[model samples]
Target chain A: MNALNLLRIAVKALQRNKLRAFLTMLGIIIGVAAVITMMSIGEGSRRSIESNLTSMGSNMITISPSSNSPGVRMSGSSIQSLTVNDVIALRNQATNLTAVSPMVSASGQVIKGALNWSTSIQGASPEYLDIRKLEVSEGISFDESDVRSSAKVCLLGKTVIDNLFPNGENPVGQIIRFNKIPFQVIGVLASKGQSGFGQDQDDIIIAPYTTVQNRVLASTYFQSIFTSAISEAASEAASEEITRILRETHRLRATEENDFSVRTQAELINTLNTTMGMLTALLTSVASISLVIGGIGIMNIMYVSVTERTREIGLRMSIGARPVDILMQFLIEAILISITGGVIGVIIGVSASVLVSGILNWPTVISEPSIVISFLVCALTGVFFGYYPAQKASRLDPIEALRYE
Target chain B: MSKILEIHDLKREFKVGSEIVRALKGVSFDVGTGEFITIMGTSGSGKSTLLNVLGCLDKPSSGTYLLDGVDLKSLNRNQLAQFRNTKIGFVFQAYNLLPRTSALENVELPLLYNPSINTKERRERAIQALEAVKLADRFDHTPNQLSGGQQQRVAIARALVNEPVMILADEATGNLDTRTSYEIMSLMQELNQVQKKTIVFVTHEPDIASFSSRTIMLRDGKVQKDTPNENLQSAREALNSLPVTEDY
Candidate 1:
């Protein structure tokens, strides 16, 4: 018989018991839906994490004093290993770096009349705003001359402005006292909601390095150095260049370990991507177990169908249907059940992903590859599971099957 | 007349719990074209086994059986299936019409296995067979919607659709009432007389056997008597003579 007739026969048989066929397909539907949803969620989180890192400056690299430096180990914040001389060496010698700035921070209370607010004071050069992707919403930033002359001018963050200058008063060009020394607010920093670590990014103050060093902290050693590469792809090269410059400027011997650590945002992004990929793989595997169970369900139903249709098989055989024809009939029926269920599952999975994102405000991305893979898996599952029952029907003895009740 | 079936010393054996049971023991028979013959036997008399062999459904353990020039012993299982599809039609006691299928489709079943017959030709042939059985008007009715007599007619149409050389029936009237049985026998008689079709029917009813021109009586796995009936009864006359009932 031709394949089309066999398919028609199989379809007719399934139509005879529509409820049973639908129930048999339920397992595959749930399995495919679960796999798609889980993978979409995993991919969504990965993309959002990447975007968050990019917002913090994709090409930004941080240089800090290494606690594991040769000699007595020192704590991270108390380490006086980095200096302005190292920053100047990196700014002048590093070929891949586009911008560099030295950082010196001190926590103290600020007073603007009777309203006082306590926040950290960050001291850096003019290029600090560009390297960290921070913007000044109003007025102007402290320039190169401000850093050279130790000018008493600083920028107010959104949180400090909300507190020190309450009642909607603008803080730019106003005078504020820090550690009993008067300073003029040069500009207002734009709001940066929060870091990936859930810390408020706008709860700080920015001033020239010379002002904080001479008039506030009174320390010569810098806490850290921040720099930006020409591009995100060049961060690795820029980091290596900074390491070389710092090592040479610190005068470390060939056998001695460098006293500084170079870290790039690219490294952090890679770590997060690897972790997300593994999570997606794990979830997809778990969901495929349900698919396996669904296949087993198909096999079980096929067995029952073969048994129930024994006499019909005998009748067909007597009418000259070959063993291969009978086999194809039952096998095609099984494949139809699974493939139909797979199509429905893909629709449901995509809608569920959208619904999840809509209701929970979570990021979700539906991928085409997952849908394609699920289809292939469903087809394979049908063939693999349907073989034994179809063979059983084909091998039935016509006489015995005719006599079956 | 040309011989449609030639069987020589055919034997069939079965192993039941390590004991050999000979269902047919050295039986021989011949049937000519346009002949109507009935094989009569009680239960366990090997009549069913002989019919199965004649229908090309079972292979004889020994000896040769030929149907329409094809050696039944030499052909493999697949070839035998093809031979059965093209050469022999079967009508069972239960009618064997697929449930929930239209009478036309049931008649089309045998032609479906023949790759040479396209869809349009298959449908035309099925309708012609149903017309031959005088069931053309009920072609759209499913088996459950038709009477037992109508269902048997549909089964006969299915048998005739492929234009086989022989119609092999196993207790074809066993499930019908006396009147319906006579009606089915009349239809078969009409096909044999008008269409020139050979028929080999298996039955235990002597009254049913009287309708055929020849009788082969089997007993104890052996053919006890093979003889031409001197007074063959016309099934149309027998059906007409029966009194009409309100239930029918």
Candidate 2:
């Protein structure tokens, strides 16, 4: 028989039951829409994280003290001993080392006459602002002279100033008492907005490393250590050199691990990105499960159609229609359902993704490759899932079918 | 094998709810070219089953049946379909025309399965077939639009479109009025005599069976009697000699 004639009959039969055909297509539409929407959200999140990490010192490295126990406190193993002596020694010994600052921090209530504010006070050298990309709004940072003399000066972050001042009042040159010690607020750090990880960034005070070390504590030891590498290329090597110097100065032998742990800023970002990427892939794949179920639904409905039309099959057979003709008719019906649903699903899914992203103020990308893959998957599912029913329809006994009421 | 249809020891048994009902017990018959034979039997006497076997719509359980020089038992499903497309035509008691389809398209159905005939030839042949049945005036009407006899005539035209050597009709006039029954019977007789088309029609009525040239009586799946109708022409003449049954 002519292929065109067979197609004509199939089209007419499918058209006879428009409501049933539409309902079947609805299942496929939902499945495909779920796949597209979930994947777009996952992709959007991945891209946002990539850019967020790039903004927070994309090539920066960070080193923190070691905490061997899972929930242990992590100041440092030798928190009471790291001093400016150790900082200067490392700066001189390592070739790729750029700057070093011995840090000491204390949380206390800051007072300025009628106003009082509580915040963490951090101390570092003049190069701390450059390393953290902090901009000083007023007054100069403490230099070598200030570190040597142990001058009591401070730099205030935007949040600390707002909490203590409220009005557009100048904080520079004002005397702010820290734990009852009179220290002058020499400058203020410009606002650095919220980090992508939801951490408040501008709620602290900066002071000279000397003042924080001597005034905040009555001890001769430092609380922490901060360092910066000359360039991104040498950051790893510089970290290793600093580790070697710390281990030797702490009187540790080669076999024994030191108390300090060094962590790179790049490594933190990498771990975060890898975990998010895995989450995206897992979520999208789980969504694909619905598509498989949709395929099964298509097969089941086709089987019902073939069985219901047995007498019609017999009628065609008597008119010289071959078994393959029946098979092709059923197969084409299934394919038409799946492909049509797939097309509508893609449109609906893409629009849904756009709507979600638009309302939430996030990014959504609908890649052409993903669309193509989705359509192909839908077509393949039709053929793969519809094969058994079509074969069963083609193998029906014409005489028995004609006898069927 | 040279005959248009031949059967030897033809038997068909069917099981219904644990009972093995033999529709056709050991029946054997042969039909040569241009022969019009009528099979007469009661409801469960297997006349329709015999026609199914003759039309190649069924397979005899344990018998040798030949149709148009090919063994019916040896042909696969696809081969049998092709053979039916070219060798056999059928008209059922129900006037089994698809009620939704137009007369011309119904006639063209068989020709579509025959690949040797192209579109122009197929349409021409289908029109000629409808013209032969005198349904050319109602070519566009669906089966429900025509009378029972016209529908049967359209079915006959469909059967003739492929120019098969024979047609097997199962109680072709059983559902029609007496006048329409005679009209359909006379059409078959004219095709048998003038066009030399062979036909085998099944019926339970003796008057309907008397219209054919030969009569084969069946009972309990077996041929009880087979003989030439030496008085067929005289019988139809006598039936026609009565007042013409009309619905004015």
Candidate 3:
């Protein structure tokens, strides 16, 4: 028989039991939707993390002093062996480095006109803002002369500004007390929101390193040295150059281990991305199980339908329908059900992803490749599961089938 | 008229759990074109087996059967289906019209298997067949909407839609009442006399068998009797004498 006629007959048969056909398609619908939702969510989070890392400066690197004590383990930032001289040495020697700053931080209560807030106070050179990709929204940043003269000028991040000066007050050129020492507000850093670890990024106060070393903490050792490479591709070379300069400046012997650790932003981002990728793969695989189960459900229904329509097969054969025609009829019916379900699934999946993003406030991105792959998988499932049942229908004996009760 | 079907020493056997049961024991017969013949026998008399063999639905174990000069045993499954599509039409005892399908679509079914017929011609031929059966107004109605006799008529129309070489009907009016049975037989009589269509009908009812031009009685897997009806009854006259029912 011609394909169109066969299809029409198959459709007519399916129409006889519309509810059963829809129920059979339900399995495939749920499977495809689940896969799409899981994949989109995973992709969204990965993209979010990548954007966050770039915002924090992709080529930025941090160098912290490691504890020199033998057989003792300590947090690298707690050793405090890095000094202003080491930063100067690296700044002069590292060719690939675009900018470098010595960082010293201390937390203290700051008061501005009876508005008091306790926040971390960071001290660094003017290069700190450029290396960290921080911009001044108002007023001016502290210059090199301010760091050399130990000028008591500071910049406040948006969070610190909100906490210390409410009602969007302009605190520029105003005096704010930090540990009972009065400092002039130089500028307000632009907002950076929260970090990937959920920590508030814009909750710090910035001052010249000389002022924090002499007056706030009364210390000469640097806590950490932050630097940025000229370009993303130069990060590794810049890291190596900084490590060599620091080791030489500290005068560590060949046999002695260097008292420093260098970390690149790219490395941290890669580790985070790897973890996210694993999670996405794990979720997608789990969702695919439902698709396989859906295929099995189709097979189960097809077998039942073949058995139910044995007499029909006989009648068609007696009316001059070839075995191949019977087979094509059944096979086309299966494909029609699955492909219809797949199209519905794609719509449901996209809508569900949008709902998740809207209601739960989670990021979700639907990739084109995922939709294409899921559609192909659905078609393959129909063919694979429908084969044996269609074959059984085609191979039936006309005499016995006609006689079947 | 020329002979349309020739059979010689036709035999059919079935293995029933290690024992071979012979269904057709070397039965032979010839049917001429435009002839209306009936093969009559009781249950277990192998007349049904003979019908199946004649319809090309079952192969003979050891026999030579030819239709229009072509060997039946030489044809494969697909070729047999093709042969049936072009050369023979079947009307079952149950009517066997597909349930929930319109009578027009059911009539068009056999033509669907013929690749040479297009959709438009198939429809036109199905309508013509239905018109011949006097069921043109009921083309859109499903089988369930029709009476037993009407359903049988639709089945006959389906059988005739392909314009096959011969019509093979097995107990075509077995489910109908006496009056409806006469009505269907009259229609078959008109088709045989006016359209010159050859027909082979199988039934155990002697009264139904009296309408055919020839009668063949089968017994113990063999032909017990084969003879022309010397006093053939006209179903049209019989229907004219019967009382008309309110449903008709």
Interface RMSD of each: 1.0, 2.0, 1.3
DockQ of 1: 0.68
Q: What TM-score would each prediction reach against the true structure?
A: 0.93, 0.74, 0.94
lDDT of 3 by residue, A1-405 (tens): 677788887898788778999999999999999999999999999999888888899999998888766887898767878998898898888899989999999998999887999998999999999989999999999999999999999999988889887887798988999999899998989999997778898998999999999999999988888999998888888888888888898988888888998999988988999999999999999999999998898999999999988888887888788889889888988888888889999999999999999999999999999999999999999999998899999999987787677
Docking class of 2: acceptable
Q: Candidate 1 chain A: minimum summed lDDT over ten consecutive residues — where?
A: A67-76
Give the distance in Å from residue A126's predicted Cα in candidate 2 to where it truly belongs: 7.3
DockQ comparisons of all candidates to the true complex: 0.68, 0.36, 0.64
Candidate 2: segments with Cα more than 4 A from true spot: A1-10, A68-193, A202-251, A264-296, A321-328, A362-388, B1-3, B13-22, B25-37, B94-165, B173-198, B205-215, B224-248
Q: Proportion of native contacts in model 1?
A: 0.58
Q: Which parts of model 3 have CA positions greater than 4 angstroms off?
A: A67-70, A93-96, A230-258, B245-248
Worst 10 residues of 1 chain B by lDDT: B69-78
Task: Give one digit per residue, the lDDT tens place, for model 3 in B40-158.
Answer: 99899898888888888889999899987889999999988888888888998888788888999899988888888888999999999999999979999999999999999999999
Higher DockQ: candidate 1 or 3? 1
lDDT of 2 by residue, A1-405 (tens): 777766666665677678888888877888888888887887788777666655555444455456443555556734455666677777778676666666677889998878888888887788777667678877767677887788998888888888788887899998988899888888888887777686777888888877877788665566666666777667678778888888777777777666666666666667877887788678778778888888989888888988888876776677677888878888888888899999999999999999999998777777777788888999998888878888988888877777677
Ranking by DockQ: 1, 3, 2
Per-residue lDDT for A100-126 in model 1, tens only? 999999889999999898888999999
